[model samples]
Target: MALFFFLTAQSQNKDLPDVGIIPKIVVKAIGVNTDIQGIIKNDSNLFKTLSSELIIISNMGAKNASKAEQKDNFSIAPDEVKIVATKNINVADTDNIIVLFLIYEDEKLIARDRKELRRQKNDPNVSDGLEIKGLVVENVRSKVGKDFYDYFYQQFTLKNPESDQLVKVEEQLGIGIGTRIQIKVQEDLVFESFARPNEEQLVNLANSAVARVLQYFKQKERQKQLLRQF
Candidate 1:
């Protein structure tokens, strides 16, 4: 059997500069399980410290950075995601920026990544910018050449058009292979299917997830274009 769910929020940024009614953006960090605990293992202090780091990096030195904490609305579920924090900042006169994240385990640096930030400078754009943080997963149960275990669950987060909000999407499957299913799409989309049966299947799932995000934007653009034409 398989199951899936999603959540969304309507948030706004209050720190953007008023520049003669220039467009405003709701920057969001997107990925799978990018919470504080997801990056590190078994460390609370480190999680808090990294949480601060994420907020700072997302701000990109803008005067009005978000003071929200990282653990806000975050939970320990199979794959539940939320808008952990929100920042009201200016994006005027800046082409783009780069944010760096460092992941460590047991006081040792294990992984690192550089995130690129570029404003969406086109009409019909849902938000000004989208930040692709990365993906993190845990609790994998496997055995040598055997698929005889039990208890399987997975979760992920989806970014909505509104600022300071995230769509927590999750799925659960156990004991058998099943067909993929696309549940629904509104401000947020939820997709549930059987667990990946192989590496190729996993890649397909990842690609489908990315396509869903792109499709959301495309739908937004379609709405905007129709309104303009009318």
Candidate 2:
């Protein structure tokens, strides 16, 4: 018998996907073999049915620096815990070993976790997103506004993806038959439009809104960082 320890590292920049499906990884040492299980969890307020890949990567610290990897694809839904993977690995002589777990949703990297005997390698550098503040307030008073909002919500959450931010979508009666729409980040206005376009246009409109909002926060972040140097 030998002594071993497992240190876990979670996703740093992102959380459970906005779609609400997240993967949970479990590891247990059974005799000389390592047991790894993958579980999916669906959180609140979002309805999503998705298939994802659960990847298990292990670093065997040896002369060759070899790595072992296993991947499996599975479908998951709300409130259901489907066993994605159960892998049994044999740990060799040295105690220095690392096991990394990743879950990808619709080919998009969504959640990850790692269990290690010790911190041998730094977690892969994940690009950080600007933390957003304020509440996401929607003022949809008409059918047009509602249509735009639907398009915007789906686009905004996926494109580039903000870490912690709230977006306020406001609508007002335009001077013409169309209605006015605007996106506000806290008090700063990032996107505004008065044209009442069709559904096709709404897709573009949503994309633009997502871009403007990200730009607004990104610029503010740069300014804050610059001021901090003083």
Candidate 3:
């Protein structure tokens, strides 16, 4: 009977729908704030890398959806893509921008996305309260990750797109992978009261956020796989 049950379980597993249908996605372009030189360059690079990773996952999901459509003998439209920018935080009185991509179909929303980088501060003594600033910044980054994930999930559901595979692709891609890239202040623009803040701290914070996002994505994907198995 034990062997019989084991064989039954194996059969059940084989009967389960495969979650491997999701295709890889590629990210081409991400939008950023153009006002600050330091912020813009760093953010652009960050988004570019992020976009490429997401594209791989999205393509996976899209492939799954396309297959489903083909099986049903229906047409699937191309994903609607757009990049959105918003001011989510302020540093030294300068607003920090959050850039994200949106994938949707017609009036329906599909996926909401973002890659964030902090804006450079011009204020003298900005680094004086580094401890306090760090704490606040950390919290902000956490919130950003949570918000981003929630938005993506919500949009994904709304679109009702074919595949649930790429939901957790963020984890596999290492969303926040490196040190916070900082803008160099020109020597001629130096302020006597200023102390240069360490960019490494920001980079660490960014990496932590990226790690969280990746984990979140992986978790979601696992959940979807479980659902399909049943």
| Candidate number of the best TM-score | 2
Q: lDDT per residue, candidate 2, 51-111, as tens digits?
A: 4444444445456455656677665555444556777766544345565666666677776
Tens-digit per-residue lDDT, 1-230, candidate 3: 00000000001123333321112111111122121110111112112221111211111223332111100011222331222222222123222223333323233333333333333334443332111100111111343343333333323332323322222312111244522221111211111111113334433443444444345446656998999999
Name the TM-score of candidate 3.
0.20
Task: Give the local distance difference test score of model 1.
Answer: 0.33
Q: CA lDDT, every prediction?
A: 0.33, 0.60, 0.25
Q: Candidate order by lDDT, highest to lowest?
A: 2, 1, 3
Looking at model 1, which ten-residue stretch has the lowest summed lDDT?
144-153
lDDT of 1 by residue, 82-173 (tens): 22333444334334444433332234433333334544444352433343322222223343111211111111222223322233334344
Rank by TM-score, highest first.
Answer: 2, 1, 3
Q: Which stretches of candidate 1 lie above 4 Å from their native place?
A: 1-166, 178-192
Cα deviation of 81, candidate 1, in Å: 20
Candidate 3's C-alpha lDDT? 0.25
For residue 52, model 1's alpha carbon misses the true position, in angstroms, by 19
